[model samples]
Target: MRGVRVLFCYLILAGSVSAQNIESLLMAGDRSAYNEIMSALQRKDFIEAIIGLNSFIPGYSSYGDLYFIRGVARMQLNDVEGARKDFILAKASGYKEENINFFISKEYLVGRLLKDLKMEIKLDSLREYRPVIESRDTIQGALRPERTCFDVYFYNLTVKILPESKSIQGSNTIFFRTTADTRIIQIDLFPRYTITSLKRDGKDLIYTRNYGGIFIDFGEIIPAGKMEEITIEYSGIPIVAPKPPWNGGFVWEQEKKRYNVGVACEHLGASSWWPNKDHLSDKPDSMIINLQVPYGYQGISNGNLRSQTDVGSGYNNFEWFVSYPINNYNVTIYMGDFVNFSEEFTNNSGKYRIDYYVLPKNLKKAREYYTQTKDVIGIFEKAFGEYPFRTDGVGLVEAPFEGMEHQGAIAIGGEYGKSNNRRDYWTKDYDYLVIHELAHEWWGNAVAIGDMADAWINEGFGTYSEFLFAEEKFGYPEYIRVAASNFSSILNIWPIVGERNINSNTFLGGDIYNKGAAMLNNLRCIINNDSLFKRIIKDFYLKNIYRIVTTDDFIRHVRDYTNTDYTGFFNKFLYETDPPVLSCSYSIDRKNNLTFNYRWTRVGPDFSMPFCIAVNNKEYIRLNGTSFPQTFSYENVNSFFLPNEYRYEKELVPPNSFTYYWTTWPF
Candidate 1:
């Protein structure tokens, strides 16, 4: 019974099975049989469950749920062949393919029977559950002719946020230069908003709405290279975030009888709350944000605050100016009863200001915890060059949600780790939220991605920055521990890079953050040169600062810098769901020599990655492995005993300690 419980726990830990699903299956069948089988399972009695299942299944041969339970019981009892047969029978008896595939993909059956099943069963299950991509997705995601006809250079946005009604009234004056001679142009705003007026140079402009896209007709063809401006006046209730930073929208909440409000629209698009192009490819060169909130509440936004003025009504207008090219999503708003504090960050370049905004109650604790911001900024400057927006200065706004890299003004949440029960990853104490969102100041805000598909560039680098911070503050072992923890969360179900031009949220999964970081770490291992790796990262950031980038761009930069083509490496790691598997075997020769053979599996035919292996857990030797088997011989080693059969066929090479891959041995 203890062994059975251990096996069940192992399966849960491996992420191969869900206990809830097992419970659901147990409760689904005939009432009397369910009672018997569930009681046995509750007691961790696999033998008793198997005895009951055998009798019940024979009586109800078509019961697929019973067969699945019997398979699970057999698996726990270490009857691999019996479990395999039961699983196949269960599938043939019309059990859910997803459940069957998940069970069969476990480590126990992976090396033995997985090859016999149609691999598409798993893929088909995924396809069955994929959300239908609508026309709105295509319009928002694709670069249509209307969107490409003009290039936005600036945006002057003024909004009056009404917390009482949970609505906003605003106008965005768009300044653009024509790229092509066309009278029609497209901008995006959620259809929920009512457009009171659309004008260009004081003349009314006609527009039509479809999905979230607004197509405007200028009534005359603006010549190529012409400069133009348009102002859109609109008002509506914005979507409230179901889950912030992940699902983007306005967050309206109250703390201590005061409004604690802000907005985050990353994947959901800035258009969720305001009118804009609503695509990653377009970034305004400079902008002004004028936000009007209720009296006594401070309104904060990206970049530097230009002024705060009482508007004579019940609102105060706080205006901000962003002096550099900015992603639309990075433009945000925070309004609350806030007090301010400032610090100066001095580096090789010069002294830059760092501002903090918090509720008046949490001011003292914020000051103490936020001192680490300077250290984080300095460390990142050394790694990724001078802070990209030093001219704008740095600002941290206490937010209602976890955190977000909202350009110069980052959103930070949590109680500064004082009362929060989350564990610390580094030897020295620091806020993961602060460190992660700050890292995005360099990765996501400074060096931006042109498409959501390459969002790993933003999140992966941000996560890896935690590794860098750990290594710089503590040591390599501590960094390894952090990296291993990140690797453990990787799902590997979807590729880090998703289908392009579809507004896909595939990168929203943990893979983009965890697996993406592990991939970068693995690349460093493959390069085997810390200085060169750091140089590559710094160079990439320096070259692409304030510019949108793609995964191919970084791959090209790595190739150019390293003097080696890493296309296959990126293809395997970024484009594929699973890492390469290094299948290994060995034989003892009569001359007391051991001959080892190795090859790559579960990868492209051209996939070749270098990895290190330690013989007898001693000194490490690096070897380059490809699809074709390679051999190496070591002399004067005694013959070792071999198990009669390989139990669990594969073990994941600890990603923290080595390159990302898997290893399998047959004896």
Candidate 2:
């Protein structure tokens, strides 16, 4: 009877592995098992999952894959020591399948778990070059009849091209979920391309090809909400040609003395060559990047550079992968003749190296200029928790424009001489642009947003961080003055509503970056508890690590942790487009009192707010009104000249046509 029981167990395990649904078995390993483990976690069956994993992991190498899985599981179980041990083992064991994501994430997650800021942990901080050929292909499985949610996965790809337009495409599968009756996959395809054809589940499917993307009608609604996998094959000129964002062939203009190039496909540029969901709300699990570039040019993408082989006919294939979940916009590529170097840094967090890939000519100047990068990195790690992506060092890609905050790699448009050219850092402090972009490794890259609406969460916070760095490295007064300057700009550009004209992308420059930063600074002042505020910021990052968040989501998080309601706070600024301007005056009275009479005219119709009024810089009182007249008095004879300072913030409910005017007793 015992032998029969053992035989039955063996059969069940075999069937599970064959079906590729060994989630139950993998669970025994740890939280790191696989995506299958995520569900078991939701149900709170952690211990059982661990047992199954321990018994089912193939070959169960205690050092590499097996140990990595164990560490992930241990983390979920709150076993920090065990998780750390497993992660270290996995890192040493060469767990490179997920772009070494397991190794890097472990370093990031453990920081919050231990709250040990002084601990020095390091990962490669490198600059990336331009992507030669990029691809993001999605496969939607046939949905089950009753399924309300369906999983969609796209392979992140980096491709290379042969001399005759022949291409080699490499991609990794990314998993996600959708609830729309039929998924509207929006791919960012800039500059346009040609679609050869497409297939669904091994069968040719009719597709509609346009500049935006090639959409295929799956024919019929989803049945049983089951799964269906769709594959597409197409090719085109590199979206970001040698000239950049829009140039077609390959020819550098000698007169320009530089390449007129840019890869500004943040958010929606991926579809310029491939098909995708195009938005931030739906992020992919893991992806593979494959590229085929002209024999002489090197192609680079999101993950660690894996292999480069000559494919003949003037074509070379390069492949990369991102093992961890990455935002759609964070996906990138770099290509050109470049020199690569790696250096090491040892600190409390661990010993890691920084890498830099720059134009060969700028080697000496690059070294001298970027020396402080390591120290600034150390400071950010202590503050923001951990670096977001894999790969070390920074990639200084040559661009025709300015710098961009690419994960792990930042593309620099200028040479080393520009470092001391008076335009280096915006405030003449430390390298503000460098520090600002690096901070995004934590805020924008690690703790991402659900949509562009919360772009302020990324840019605003990043800009604020720049100021904070200025304050710390420069001085507090500089910081205060910076904040005031931003506030003043916001006041000038006060829109009656948050509605920005898409045609005019410039609106975001002031409102999103400057105004948003000022509002955050003001909130910090009001909160007053630096210790508590700092913890809240840290907690926010830790809680949402590795996932994309939204503005409402951010507000809710502040609401939950701060034990305070920020609904009013956000409603007043972010929700309302128009800000109120105060106008009022007062007269002296015989009863040792000053009679104040004031009428307010808002910037818009729906204007309503509460503000502070100061007289002679001595007496401060609160005034309230909304597009109407109100009068109040101060009990105490004031100075011969009553200097009234009107201090107020905008409310969120104002309409597009709103404006304000103020009149007082003295007038």
Candidate 3:
């Protein structure tokens, strides 16, 4: 509240309100009234301030600063609607957009106030204002009893894309094995679609629709260990994506005259357009996708393209088959007037095919630009074992939006340019979109997460792969420089892991990508053995290929591999929002000898991490920091430099070799 009052005073004195206007309105007597209102606001007496402003506003109706102050008071009183109106009025009355927008944007307002005002507001307390989870989200995100009774093994989907009308008609034949005897089961599809028929062995079945859940009754108790199949016939217009990949839906666009169609549904449930068990826990062992599109356009999906056959007048069916277990959301389709090209990647493991699908206009550029894929793949293979889907072959499709890691058919966008030009360290030109999505082929597609809460495993590893790529392609100096740039983006407002069993959008933030990668890098510094760290990552990927895993599974694996327990490390970085703080104090004796005391703060009792420091700005030393204080003395030292503070000076120490905020007392 004091900061709010100071901002108001600055705005008034800095010409947001002209002296002529204030002088005319105040008339040398009413100035004290305005001062009283601001004093009330400074005291956190919002009600008194609002009352004073109510009387003062009618006299000086054109004063935008007055409206701005009233808006702040209204917001403090939880009158958001009234505050919004006052903010708009302030802008219309000539208040600077930059100043008013600080109160208008919710995310910026909360973050700024939390910092400048030093408010005693916990981020957890803000959860009460978050969007409430509805019944539909529960049915789609949770593994209820109805969904847990059956395990899906395969999916045979046939769909026809009518891009002219922006609609689709499809049928999915689900093959599942019953784990428990039950007379009913649940399948999910958006309620907007019409279910023409639900059948088992060509006989109609009884079912009821509730939101996205379609509960079907079989009329008889299916015995345990029984395999059954059901084909659901449905058709509808899928939701159009306002902003793709982030807003999960279908993208229907036109490249000149030809239609470009694709769908991405990572956060948005797959049930938005298809019928299946939408939860993440159940991934089909294999899949067959048949997409029928206009004869001139090519239809693409995950895995290998088996065949393209003319089905009828003006249409052709492109059949695809996936041989390994796949996440439901990773299943996708792309349709456009595309030109195809291929190359063979021969490595020590074996030979594999890499396919590129691009618009006919960019075929020549794509051929030259996409050659880097081979080198990237080779780097990943050397670091984390061979590619996971050797049999299916790798595919990259040009997408309308940024990018998405759709199993084998990765989406590539960003206009095929270097994505991180904001940092001067990027001396090489490379497509970050391609590298990031390709990395997902190993981290997200092959080694998947069972619940969205553990999305850090998918995105964190994918982002870290970029660091690995930098080390191999550009050298270690470039890698450390880029890692420093990546670490600067961490918000640390929320924990990397979120609550399970609900469809949470926490992974949409940069923390999951930046902070998660930083956490892994810190772990490497703690292990202090580069070869062993690489071995641990490679073994983890090899062991869990084509499998669903959780954060706990990774913790257990690391514990067994290194013979050292890092449970407290993971708990501090993943489950908590604040990073550990390193507290230090130093004193120089009369003889110029330096004595330093350092320890960790704002961490658990069991937390301890080793970080490097430069003594006397010359020699390097590594010290283990714990909750308890430890001291180190150096003779005739001039200065001590902590690596965490001077990260850009890479020659002195490596950047992000450890993770912590640092504070030091005067000598």
lDDT of 3 by residue, 256-333 (tens): 788988997887888888898888888999999999998889999999889999999788999999999888888999
Error of 2 at 477 (Å): 1.6
Candidate 3 lDDT score at position 627: 89
> Which residues of candidate 1, in runs, are more than 4 Å off?
1-129, 586-595, 614-622, 632-657
Candidate 3's error at 403, in angstroms?
Answer: 1.4
Per residue, candidate 2 scores C-alpha lDDT tens digits across 375-479 of 667666665665555343344444433455666556555464364472333343356556666777777777886545566677677767766665656665456
Clashes of 1: 0
Q: Give the TM-score of candidate 3.
A: 0.80
The alpha-carbon root-mean-square deviation between model 2 and the true structure, to one decimal in Å, is 28.7
- Pairs of residues at least 3 apart in sequence or in different chains that clash in candidate 1: none
Give the lDDT of residue 439 in candidate 2. 75
lDDT of 1 by residue, 368-432 (tens): 88978988888889888998888898999988876888988898876666766423666445777
Superposed by TM-score, candidate 3 places the C-alpha of residue 377 at a distance from the truth, in angstroms, of 0.5
Give lDDT for model 3.
0.76
What is the lDDT for 225 in model 2? Answer: 45
* RMSD from true fold, candidate 1: 9.0
